[model samples]
Target: MDKPKRRNTETDPWSGLKMYTAARIALGRTGTSVPLKESFAFKMAHAHARDAVYSSLNLEVLLQGLHAFNLPVHVLHSMASDRMEYLQRPDLGRMLNQASSEQLKEEGSSSTEIAFVLADGLSATAVNEHAIPLLQLLVPALRQAGFTLAPLTVAEQARVAIADEIGELLHAKLSIIMIGERPGLSSPDSLGVYFTYAPKPGLTDEARNCISNIRPEGLPYSLAAEKILYLIQEAMRKKLTGVKLKDGIGLLQG
Candidate 1:
């Protein structure tokens, strides 16, 4: 038996072409067999797994970021080192403790047209990433538009309902609370803002206007700021917000 002839460029012009074709087929470019190792689905799954680990909120980092803003901070419940404690005790998260409430009452402004508050609702990463920038953009815009701003507050262990509590604490005609929205795989650092006109206890979500997903991939800061200011103006003009304000006034009109 004779050995198969070795093909080379010197021997045959088609040798390189044959080698290339064989390599391509071996790499599954011909689609005879699925390339499980290099498949897009496999790469995507690996990417998602990495993101799940890295995108998780670091509350300590988040707190440091908020502190950099030089805003007043208050905790609603006893500080717990455990994340589960903070998540499980939502009742503790809803209202400021007596000491915090007193301090808020003593230190916070009593009268203002609008008050701004930040809360780590679910994704503390949201506050660190989106909340501060959004608030910074909004506050100056509101002031430029002749809206008065109360002292800003950072509420720990706070929920959405705590906006009403902070509103009542500051006695503000309108209150805007920026919170970390529940994280999804697509948006781990999403920020949401809820604005309540004439905010007080017993108010529901229906009693406030909300702007969600304020991260870079969502609404831009300048646009979000403009929309918030416009909504505040509209709420003042109509004396209502949330569900009561018909015609969807001040909502991102073309």
Candidate 2:
């Protein structure tokens, strides 16, 4: 019997296409099957995605990292007590536990211009790695923009909506939730920022603006910070965000 022909990946017409993006594309073949190396790579990517989802945020590391910014920080938890419950009950993840709410209330009712919430969303790996660095950039920028910041809030088992609850409890005019985005095969450690102006409980998704795919290999830190700062500036001037307010990419040109 003749052996099957293996397509030389180096000479495959489609191999060069991979240079354009991180997407899985242009895989070479062996006879009628995908190349063994490609199959192994796919499985590896899948493992990373799964691991990102189940990973727990290192609370001590996160807290210590936040302290480096010299800002007051508070820890909070969602009603969903565990990762299993967080995944199974998203609604619970979007609300603070009773203790967390009271803790925010005790901190005072002053209306801060912005509140930052670091949340362990779908990809804890993303949050654990990227949140502090992003916050380091964002906090200083917001201060320079004349926005008063609330004490930093670190939330566990949290969803984007949890930022609204924290903002409302802290009497903040805006809420920025830095969370781990849903991991994709090629991008397991992507973080996301969801900004909501005039955040309050029960506000719908249409009331927020999101900047996603924030990682070293995805959206670089400086660009992400610029975009976020742009949104915050626009949100303040327009007194709104979400569907009505556009990203104003053109504003970046000048």
Candidate 3:
């Protein structure tokens, strides 16, 4: 007996393109707006995106994941007391809380070659979901490269600039902060990585290098690690980062 043919429910000409990207594209329409199911899907996606932004990190869980690597982990807080303040006052999120500063000081003022920081940026969900897995691959690779690692620092209510203060406090030659990126309509769990060389408080955006959109569907962990490791080696060699330093991943691959 012959089997019946399967019919394609997505009739839009551009529907095939959906396979290429996560972007909301070629959504089938009814009159002016999308079909009821598609419209409802859009609403659900928006809710997920919003939830990712407002969510708080479970620091204990993150600590447990980091501890599995057998590395020293320290918890720190930004000056922002809560998520509300963190959203409203970005500058506060860029500085460590007084107690956190004291804690870092007590950990000792000895300089290290490099420090790794993890932070809950605009999307705590992203950090909770993706940061540790990337670190699982990155930390060992960094060690194999002969980099002396400092105690890993986990910062709550943090901004990318917070790494500068943490790096300065630890006297690290370089600091890499893995943080949650702002959620998009489709990418609620995308993570970001930022690096600063000889980080300090007054440094501008031009002083750091960023690799963004890291997730399973975005930049895969292994490739992101390779790019980051390449950048760090170059940053150390040139004693620079940010605009002046080029991401040599392509060149290295070539």
Candidate 4:
């Protein structure tokens, strides 16, 4: 009987497609199992995803970076006391703690047209990396459009819905939260933005619009800003978001 022929990855039919994407497409096999290199690469990607999930955001560094925007910034915390509790009790992560609530106390209703919130969601790595770069583009465009902006709020152990309460407290008609999205094996640092009109406590996910994958490699900062700004303008005009609203690429041009 002839010896079993060895497989060479270079000759694999799918190998040519590897250059087009970061996805796992052409991993060659060793007999019936994945090759050692592919298996090791997958494990490393998995480790990165786990690390991103458990990572902590450096508040001081983040705050410093945000200071360039020349807006008042506050650090807030969710009802969850720690990462463990945040993971175990997701509901707690969606609400503000007593002190955080007090911090927003004096903001009267309709103080601003929009409030921007940054939260260390499932992937702090994402917030720490992409949040500011995206904001750099977004804030200026919003200002030029004559939108009144509220102070920036950065929260810890937070979930997506926490922005609703923050926006409510800040008395903003619209609330935008830039959060770290759940990490995938290939995307350990994907950022997501959720915006809602008439933000208030107890609002559901259906009341918001999301712009996701704001990392440089995923959705470039400029493009993300464009999409977000378009949503903001339309939401302001239409006075709604979520399922009821739709994306319109036709942004007004000068």
Candidate 5:
């Protein structure tokens, strides 16, 4: 006689009965192979576990991603041989060196209507990525509106206050500075834009207008550029900015 073929189902009637009974009791219905992993509860539990891991890492990775833009603008440190010296000396970063200042004085036009400065304030990566695209958008827009942009400058070891210095140096009617903001573990490579009408030393934050969070995850580059232009126009008209201007104004507000 041919050997009996083994069945996929339980051969023992009692065992099969017990499994069936347990399935009905535990799951309200059942078949073989519990199917626990395929259930909705298992999927939801797995998703939560993945999310927990991502939340722990936070925004630093996202900020670093901004550096991938690989912009073509000149970096001040590359042009200056003493980049490390300036970084070590905060005072040096606050003002252009004698050579650079003199160069600007000689080559810079006195009738400059607006000045654009890019600075690696805290995160060079942020300025390298966001600032270039923003300027690409802004420079053309301003030009179309019949405004002249002064020779652009990229400052090394720059602080936000340097905008005032550049504005004074160029005699620009308005100065716009794109700088890297203080990196948070949550937001490492964020960029900030500061616009000042007639910037000068000792000018408070209240005298400047700021558009911050210019990264892929924060403010998109195109939108940030437009807002900066709008703010510059308003600042020129009102002769003031910052807290004095109406808050909650701009394309982003909508």
Candidate 6:
């Protein structure tokens, strides 16, 4: 018998470009509906995104990793009380609990160049996976620049702004927070960094500069560190962040 002809569905024109990214693209369709494989893959991605949102920070692992940095580490909480409250009452997550506030005031250093904060935000899995690695690369650069660093603060059930209070209490000139970014179907475990000069309570988003999508598959640790270091140096030199401090990497580099 002659070899049988195999059946093939219509292939997307962009199928060749699919290899360049993890984005959903070029899924070959079967008849009037999406192929079962693509549908299932989408469902799986959605599940991963959802799981990232609900995940808890593994503090023990985080603390152990932080200790190697040799800075006094303080674990704090937002007024949200729990994950549910943190999600529902965003205002509460912007401030620290009473005891946590007092502790920072008492133990935190005075007038440091920068304060590093790690917060478990929308996706704790992101922080658990990427925060330390980024910090490990950036911290040494800060130290070499003769900048004084405040104690490392780790906050659970927290949001980005809570670092403002931490930096203010510590009397830090600048605050850089590494937080878990909200999950997306294609990027469930993305870490984000927010750098603010002259941080204080009640400051809005415009007062800070954000470096987002930090991950091995996205922005790798070394490049992220380089950008952060540049931002910090520029922010310190210019006494500002936010929209004013543009990222001038190679252009400004001598």
Instruction: Give each model a TM-score.
Output: 0.70, 0.93, 0.93, 0.92, 0.64, 0.94
Error (Å) of candidate 4 at residue 40 is 1.0
Q: What is the TM-score (0 to 1) of candidate 3? A: 0.93
Error (Å) of candidate 5 at residue 140 is 1.4
User: Residue 91 lDDT in model 6?
Assistant: 96
Q: Lowest summed lDDT over 10 consecutive residues: which window, candidate 3?
A: 6-15
Q: After superposition, how far is residue 115 of candidate 4 from its true place, in Å?
A: 0.4
Q: Model 4, range 115-176, lDDT digits (tens) per residue?
A: 99999999999999898888889888999999999989999999999999999899898999
Per-residue lDDT of 95 in model 4: 98
Model 5 CA deviation exceeding 4 Å by range: 1-89, 247-254
lDDT of 1 by residue, 51-130 (tens): 43234344565556556546555444323324566677766666766776787788747588887877777766687777
Off by over 4 Å in 4: 1-10, 107-110, 250-254
**Per-residue C-alpha lDDT of model 5 across residues 27-71, encoded as one tens digit per residue:** 322465445644665456456433322221112332343233332
Task: State the C-alpha lDDT per candidate.
Answer: 0.70, 0.90, 0.90, 0.91, 0.65, 0.91
Better of 1 and 2 by lDDT: 2
Once superposed on the true structure, which residue ranges of model 6 sit more than 4 Å away at CA? 1-9
Query: Which tens-of-lDDT digit does each residue in 120-150 have in candidate 6?
Result: 8999999999998888888888899899999
TM-score of 6: 0.94
Residue range 1-254, candidate 3, lDDT tens digits: 98998887657677789999988888777888888998898899999889988888888889999898786789999999999999999999999999999988888857788889999898989899899889888888888999888888999999999999999888899989999899998898899999999998989899999999999999999999889989999999999999999986797679
Per-residue lDDT of 1-254 in model 2, one digit per residue for the tens? 99999876568676788898999777867899889999999999999999999988899999999998776899999999899999999999999999999898899867788888998899989998898888889888888888898889999999999999999988888899999999999999999999999999999999999999999999998889999999998898899989998987766696
Q: Quote model 2's TM-score.
A: 0.93
| C-alpha RMSD (angstroms) for model 5 | 15.3
